[model samples]
Target: MPSSSVPSSPSWHTRVELPSDVPAVHELTVAAFGRPTEAELLGRLRTDAGWIDALSVVVTLATDTGSPVGHVVLTRAFIDDVPALAMGPVSVHPDHQRSGAGSAAVRASLDAARAMGERYVFLLGHPSYYPRFGFGRASAHGVTLTVDAPDEAWMALSLTPAEHPLPSGTARWAAAFAMP
Candidate 1:
Protein backbone atom coordinates (compact mmCIF):
# COMPACT_ATOMS: atom_id res chain seq x y z
CA MET A 1 0.00 0.00 0.00
CA PRO A 2 1.12 3.58 -0.61
CA SER A 3 2.24 5.55 2.42
CA SER A 4 0.54 8.59 3.93
CA SER A 5 -0.39 11.35 1.53
CA VAL A 6 1.45 14.67 1.73
CA PRO A 7 -0.06 18.11 1.24
CA SER A 8 -0.95 18.51 -2.41
CA SER A 9 -3.00 20.47 -4.88
CA PRO A 10 -6.69 19.57 -4.91
CA SER A 11 -6.22 17.58 -8.08
CA TRP A 12 -3.59 15.19 -6.77
CA HIS A 13 -1.89 13.77 -3.68
CA THR A 14 1.65 12.62 -2.99
CA ARG A 15 2.80 9.42 -1.30
CA VAL A 16 5.68 6.99 -1.19
CA GLU A 17 5.75 4.86 -4.32
CA LEU A 18 4.40 1.37 -3.96
CA PRO A 19 6.19 -1.55 -5.62
CA SER A 20 3.33 -1.68 -8.11
CA ASP A 21 4.19 1.82 -9.31
CA VAL A 22 7.41 0.73 -11.04
CA PRO A 23 6.16 0.56 -14.60
CA ALA A 24 4.17 3.76 -14.41
CA VAL A 25 7.15 5.56 -12.88
CA HIS A 26 9.43 4.38 -15.68
CA GLU A 27 7.02 5.60 -18.31
CA LEU A 28 6.48 8.93 -16.56
CA THR A 29 10.23 9.44 -16.23
CA VAL A 30 10.91 8.71 -19.88
CA ALA A 31 8.07 11.02 -20.85
CA ALA A 32 9.34 13.82 -18.64
CA PHE A 33 12.88 13.74 -19.95
CA GLY A 34 12.01 12.79 -23.55
CA ARG A 35 14.76 10.18 -23.29
CA PRO A 36 15.59 6.89 -21.66
CA THR A 37 18.63 8.13 -19.76
CA GLU A 38 16.92 9.14 -16.55
CA ALA A 39 14.50 6.26 -16.68
CA GLU A 40 17.45 3.92 -17.08
CA LEU A 41 19.14 5.65 -14.19
CA LEU A 42 16.05 5.06 -12.07
CA GLY A 43 16.22 1.36 -12.80
CA ARG A 44 19.89 1.19 -11.98
CA LEU A 45 19.40 3.14 -8.78
CA ARG A 46 16.66 0.77 -7.68
CA THR A 47 19.14 -2.11 -7.69
CA ASP A 48 22.08 -0.15 -6.42
CA ALA A 49 23.14 0.12 -2.80
CA GLY A 50 21.77 3.65 -2.70
CA TRP A 51 18.12 2.76 -3.16
CA ILE A 52 15.87 3.82 -0.30
CA ASP A 53 12.53 2.13 -0.71
CA ALA A 54 10.68 4.64 1.42
CA LEU A 55 12.08 7.63 -0.38
CA SER A 56 10.73 6.88 -3.80
CA VAL A 57 7.67 9.11 -4.04
CA VAL A 58 4.80 9.66 -6.44
CA VAL A 59 2.00 12.07 -7.15
CA THR A 60 -1.34 10.48 -7.95
CA LEU A 61 -4.29 12.24 -9.48
CA ALA A 62 -7.27 12.33 -7.15
CA THR A 63 -9.84 12.23 -9.97
CA ASP A 64 -8.06 9.78 -12.23
CA THR A 65 -8.35 6.52 -10.40
CA GLY A 66 -5.19 7.43 -8.46
CA SER A 67 -2.67 6.60 -11.18
CA PRO A 68 0.66 8.31 -10.63
CA VAL A 69 1.28 11.50 -12.59
CA GLY A 70 4.62 12.46 -11.11
CA HIS A 71 7.58 10.99 -9.24
CA VAL A 72 10.86 11.75 -7.41
CA VAL A 73 13.42 9.83 -5.39
CA LEU A 74 15.94 10.61 -2.65
CA THR A 75 18.73 8.08 -2.53
CA ARG A 76 21.84 7.50 -0.45
CA ALA A 77 24.86 9.63 -1.32
CA PHE A 78 27.64 11.09 0.76
CA ILE A 79 29.64 14.19 1.50
CA ASP A 80 33.08 12.74 2.23
CA ASP A 81 31.93 10.00 4.63
CA VAL A 82 29.01 11.92 6.10
CA PRO A 83 25.74 10.44 4.82
CA ALA A 84 23.38 12.63 2.84
CA LEU A 85 20.85 12.31 0.02
CA ALA A 86 20.89 12.84 -3.70
CA MET A 87 17.60 13.92 -5.23
CA GLY A 88 17.08 13.17 -8.83
CA PRO A 89 15.27 11.71 -11.80
CA VAL A 90 12.26 13.77 -10.81
CA SER A 91 9.51 13.21 -13.31
CA VAL A 92 5.97 14.29 -14.14
CA HIS A 93 3.93 12.72 -16.89
CA PRO A 94 4.02 14.87 -19.99
CA ASP A 95 0.35 15.63 -19.68
CA HIS A 96 0.89 16.77 -16.12
CA GLN A 97 3.83 19.07 -16.85
CA ARG A 98 3.47 22.62 -15.52
CA SER A 99 0.45 21.51 -13.50
CA GLY A 100 2.23 21.38 -10.10
CA ALA A 101 2.45 17.60 -9.89
CA GLY A 102 6.25 17.71 -10.16
CA SER A 103 6.60 20.26 -7.43
CA ALA A 104 4.21 18.38 -5.18
CA ALA A 105 6.14 15.13 -5.57
CA VAL A 106 9.49 16.80 -4.92
CA ARG A 107 8.18 18.60 -1.86
CA ALA A 108 6.64 15.44 -0.49
CA SER A 109 9.83 13.46 -1.03
CA LEU A 110 11.84 16.11 0.82
CA ASP A 111 9.35 16.09 3.67
CA ALA A 112 9.57 12.31 3.85
CA ALA A 113 13.36 12.51 3.99
CA ARG A 114 13.22 15.04 6.78
CA ALA A 115 10.79 12.88 8.69
CA MET A 116 13.21 9.99 8.28
CA GLY A 117 15.85 12.18 9.99
CA GLU A 118 17.83 12.95 6.85
CA ARG A 119 19.75 16.17 7.20
CA TYR A 120 20.94 17.23 3.77
CA VAL A 121 20.16 16.82 0.09
CA PHE A 122 22.12 17.68 -3.03
CA LEU A 123 21.26 17.65 -6.70
CA LEU A 124 22.32 18.82 -10.10
CA GLY A 125 19.22 20.55 -11.40
CA HIS A 126 17.68 23.78 -12.50
CA PRO A 127 19.01 26.50 -10.23
CA SER A 128 15.86 28.53 -10.73
CA TYR A 129 13.51 25.71 -9.89
CA TYR A 130 15.21 24.11 -6.86
CA PRO A 131 15.82 27.32 -4.97
CA ARG A 132 12.09 27.42 -4.39
CA PHE A 133 12.67 24.44 -2.12
CA GLY A 134 15.46 26.18 -0.15
CA PHE A 135 18.32 24.75 -2.24
CA GLY A 136 21.34 26.98 -2.67
CA ARG A 137 24.49 26.57 -4.73
CA ALA A 138 26.37 23.65 -3.24
CA SER A 139 29.71 25.19 -3.98
CA ALA A 140 28.75 28.22 -1.92
CA HIS A 141 29.06 26.00 1.12
CA GLY A 142 32.17 24.08 -0.04
CA VAL A 143 30.46 21.07 -1.59
CA THR A 144 31.98 19.98 -4.90
CA LEU A 145 31.03 17.35 -7.44
CA THR A 146 33.21 14.92 -9.30
CA VAL A 147 31.07 15.34 -12.36
CA ASP A 148 31.54 18.37 -14.47
CA ALA A 149 28.34 20.36 -14.31
CA PRO A 150 27.54 24.03 -14.56
CA ASP A 151 28.31 25.63 -11.22
CA GLU A 152 24.89 27.13 -10.86
CA ALA A 153 23.16 23.84 -11.57
CA TRP A 154 24.70 22.13 -8.54
CA MET A 155 22.59 22.77 -5.46
CA ALA A 156 22.15 21.63 -1.88
CA LEU A 157 19.54 21.83 0.86
CA SER A 158 20.17 21.41 4.56
CA LEU A 159 16.88 20.02 5.78
CA THR A 160 17.85 20.62 9.38
CA PRO A 161 19.90 23.77 8.91
CA ALA A 162 19.87 24.87 12.55
CA GLU A 163 20.78 21.46 13.90
CA HIS A 164 23.08 20.18 11.15
CA PRO A 165 25.02 22.54 8.98
CA LEU A 166 25.87 21.51 5.43
CA PRO A 167 29.10 19.54 5.29
CA SER A 168 31.97 20.61 3.10
CA GLY A 169 33.37 17.98 0.76
CA THR A 170 33.06 16.41 -2.66
CA ALA A 171 29.74 14.73 -3.28
CA ARG A 172 29.99 11.00 -3.85
CA TRP A 173 26.98 9.78 -5.73
CA ALA A 174 25.78 6.24 -6.15
CA ALA A 175 27.80 4.12 -8.56
CA ALA A 176 24.86 4.16 -10.92
CA PHE A 177 25.25 7.89 -11.41
CA ALA A 178 28.66 7.23 -13.08
CA MET A 179 30.05 10.30 -11.37
CA PRO A 180 33.84 10.31 -11.24
Candidate 2:
Protein backbone atom coordinates (compact mmCIF):
# COMPACT_ATOMS: atom_id res chain seq x y z
CA MET A 1 0.00 0.00 0.00
CA PRO A 2 3.02 2.28 -0.05
CA SER A 3 2.54 2.90 -3.72
CA SER A 4 3.45 6.26 -5.23
CA SER A 5 0.17 6.48 -7.07
CA VAL A 6 -2.20 9.19 -5.83
CA PRO A 7 -5.20 11.01 -7.17
CA SER A 8 -4.87 14.00 -9.50
CA SER A 9 -5.92 16.21 -6.63
CA PRO A 10 -5.47 13.81 -3.83
CA SER A 11 -7.99 13.89 -1.03
CA TRP A 12 -5.14 13.60 1.36
CA HIS A 13 -6.08 13.41 5.00
CA THR A 14 -3.57 14.99 7.35
CA ARG A 15 -3.34 14.92 11.11
CA VAL A 16 -0.87 15.63 13.87
CA GLU A 17 1.80 13.00 14.37
CA LEU A 18 1.04 10.50 17.06
CA PRO A 19 3.72 8.90 19.21
CA SER A 20 3.62 5.98 16.84
CA ASP A 21 4.56 8.17 13.89
CA VAL A 22 8.10 8.75 15.07
CA PRO A 23 9.58 5.75 13.34
CA ALA A 24 7.82 6.34 10.05
CA VAL A 25 8.73 10.02 10.08
CA HIS A 26 12.34 9.18 10.75
CA GLU A 27 12.26 6.73 7.90
CA LEU A 28 10.65 9.17 5.50
CA THR A 29 13.07 11.93 6.45
CA VAL A 30 16.00 9.67 5.73
CA ALA A 31 14.51 8.34 2.54
CA ALA A 32 13.65 11.80 1.26
CA PHE A 33 17.06 13.32 1.93
CA GLY A 34 19.10 10.17 1.33
CA ARG A 35 20.89 10.79 4.66
CA PRO A 36 20.55 10.68 8.41
CA THR A 37 21.52 14.31 9.00
CA GLU A 38 18.01 15.67 8.75
CA ALA A 39 16.59 12.70 10.57
CA GLU A 40 18.92 13.33 13.50
CA LEU A 41 18.09 16.99 13.34
CA LEU A 42 14.41 16.12 13.51
CA GLY A 43 14.89 13.95 16.56
CA ARG A 44 16.68 16.75 18.38
CA LEU A 45 14.11 19.27 17.31
CA ARG A 46 11.30 17.15 18.70
CA THR A 47 12.73 17.37 22.18
CA ASP A 48 13.24 21.12 22.02
CA ALA A 49 10.80 23.73 23.24
CA GLY A 50 10.33 24.93 19.69
CA TRP A 51 8.43 21.80 18.93
CA ILE A 52 4.69 22.35 18.62
CA ASP A 53 2.42 19.36 18.75
CA ALA A 54 -0.07 20.64 16.23
CA LEU A 55 2.59 21.66 13.76
CA SER A 56 4.10 18.22 13.33
CA VAL A 57 1.63 16.99 10.78
CA VAL A 58 1.45 13.80 8.73
CA VAL A 59 -0.45 12.77 5.63
CA THR A 60 -2.80 9.94 6.51
CA LEU A 61 -4.13 7.59 3.90
CA ALA A 62 -7.32 5.61 3.45
CA THR A 63 -5.45 2.40 2.97
CA ASP A 64 -5.42 -0.28 5.64
CA THR A 65 -1.64 0.07 5.90
CA GLY A 66 -2.31 3.17 8.03
CA SER A 67 1.19 4.55 7.90
CA PRO A 68 1.79 8.15 6.94
CA VAL A 69 3.29 8.77 3.54
CA GLY A 70 4.40 12.36 4.18
CA HIS A 71 5.52 14.63 6.99
CA VAL A 72 6.34 18.30 7.59
CA VAL A 73 7.39 20.23 10.67
CA LEU A 74 6.81 23.79 11.83
CA THR A 75 8.85 24.63 14.85
CA ARG A 76 8.97 27.90 16.72
CA ALA A 77 11.68 30.20 15.41
CA PHE A 78 12.12 33.92 15.71
CA ILE A 79 12.84 37.14 13.88
CA ASP A 80 14.77 39.53 16.13
CA ASP A 81 12.93 38.13 19.18
CA VAL A 82 9.55 38.27 17.55
CA PRO A 83 7.87 34.86 17.31
CA ALA A 84 7.72 33.11 13.96
CA LEU A 85 7.96 29.59 12.60
CA ALA A 86 10.60 27.56 10.82
CA MET A 87 9.37 24.82 8.52
CA GLY A 88 11.69 22.08 7.44
CA PRO A 89 12.73 18.46 6.95
CA VAL A 90 9.58 18.20 4.94
CA SER A 91 9.48 14.87 3.21
CA VAL A 92 7.26 12.48 1.32
CA HIS A 93 8.32 8.87 1.21
CA PRO A 94 10.31 8.33 -1.99
CA ASP A 95 7.50 6.03 -3.02
CA HIS A 96 5.13 8.97 -2.81
CA GLN A 97 7.29 11.98 -3.68
CA ARG A 98 5.49 13.33 -6.72
CA SER A 99 2.08 12.17 -5.65
CA GLY A 100 0.92 15.29 -3.82
CA ALA A 101 1.57 13.84 -0.38
CA GLY A 102 4.20 16.44 0.53
CA SER A 103 2.05 19.34 -0.56
CA ALA A 104 -0.89 18.06 1.45
CA ALA A 105 1.15 17.77 4.62
CA VAL A 106 2.67 21.22 4.17
CA ARG A 107 -0.66 22.81 3.48
CA ALA A 108 -2.20 21.16 6.52
CA SER A 109 0.65 22.31 8.76
CA LEU A 110 0.40 25.86 7.43
CA ASP A 111 -3.33 25.94 7.85
CA ALA A 112 -2.98 24.72 11.42
CA ALA A 113 -0.44 27.48 12.05
CA ARG A 114 -2.70 30.11 10.58
CA ALA A 115 -5.55 28.93 12.73
CA MET A 116 -3.30 29.45 15.72
CA GLY A 117 -2.78 33.02 14.51
CA GLU A 118 0.80 32.45 13.42
CA ARG A 119 1.98 35.20 11.10
CA TYR A 120 5.34 34.41 9.66
CA VAL A 121 6.91 31.12 8.57
CA PHE A 122 10.42 30.71 7.23
CA LEU A 123 12.48 27.86 5.83
CA LEU A 124 15.62 27.10 3.91
CA GLY A 125 14.42 25.02 1.02
CA HIS A 126 14.02 24.78 -2.73
CA PRO A 127 13.31 28.12 -4.38
CA SER A 128 11.18 26.78 -7.16
CA TYR A 129 9.09 24.33 -5.16
CA TYR A 130 8.01 26.47 -2.18
CA PRO A 131 6.69 29.58 -3.86
CA ARG A 132 3.41 28.00 -4.74
CA PHE A 133 2.62 28.10 -1.05
CA GLY A 134 3.31 31.88 -1.07
CA PHE A 135 6.95 31.83 0.01
CA GLY A 136 9.35 34.37 -1.45
CA ARG A 137 12.97 35.25 -0.90
CA ALA A 138 13.49 36.10 2.75
CA SER A 139 16.30 38.46 1.85
CA ALA A 140 13.85 40.44 -0.22
CA HIS A 141 12.18 41.33 3.05
CA GLY A 142 15.61 41.75 4.67
CA VAL A 143 15.47 38.39 6.45
CA THR A 144 18.54 36.17 6.78
CA LEU A 145 19.55 33.02 8.63
CA THR A 146 22.49 32.43 10.97
CA VAL A 147 24.30 30.49 8.28
CA ASP A 148 24.97 31.50 4.74
CA ALA A 149 22.29 30.32 2.35
CA PRO A 150 21.73 31.21 -1.24
CA ASP A 151 19.45 34.27 -1.29
CA GLU A 152 16.74 32.51 -3.20
CA ALA A 153 16.77 29.30 -1.19
CA TRP A 154 15.94 31.01 2.07
CA MET A 155 12.30 31.96 1.98
CA ALA A 156 9.40 33.12 4.15
CA LEU A 157 5.63 33.09 3.90
CA SER A 158 3.15 35.41 5.56
CA LEU A 159 0.05 33.72 6.84
CA THR A 160 -1.18 37.02 8.24
CA PRO A 161 0.78 39.52 6.22
CA ALA A 162 -1.59 42.43 6.60
CA GLU A 163 -1.23 42.19 10.37
CA HIS A 164 2.29 40.90 10.97
CA PRO A 165 4.94 41.63 8.40
CA LEU A 166 7.90 39.26 8.73
CA PRO A 167 10.09 41.31 11.03
CA SER A 168 13.37 41.92 9.31
CA GLY A 169 16.68 40.79 10.72
CA THR A 170 18.43 37.48 11.47
CA ALA A 171 15.99 34.54 11.69
CA ARG A 172 16.72 32.73 14.94
CA TRP A 173 15.97 29.07 14.48
CA ALA A 174 15.71 26.58 17.30
CA ALA A 175 18.96 25.85 19.11
CA ALA A 176 19.10 22.40 17.56
CA PHE A 177 19.68 24.04 14.20
CA ALA A 178 22.48 26.25 15.44
CA MET A 179 25.56 26.29 13.26
CA PRO A 180 27.81 23.33 13.86
Candidate 1: regions farther than 4 A off: 1-10
What TM-score would each prediction reach against the true structure? 0.93, 0.92
Q: Compared with the true structure, what per-residue lDDT tens digits does model 1 show for residues 35-139?
A: 999999999999999999999999988777458989999999999999999999899988888888888899999999999999999999998899999999999
Candidate No. with top TM-score: 1
Clashes of 1: 0
lDDT of 2 by residue, 1-180 (tens): 687965465457889999999998999899988999999999999999999998999996645236988899999998888899999889888888878888889999999999998999999999989999999999989987778789989999889888877779889998888752
Best candidate (score: lDDT): 1
What C-alpha lDDT does candidate 1 achieve relative to the native structure? 0.92
Lowest lDDT 10-residue stretch of candidate 2: 60-69
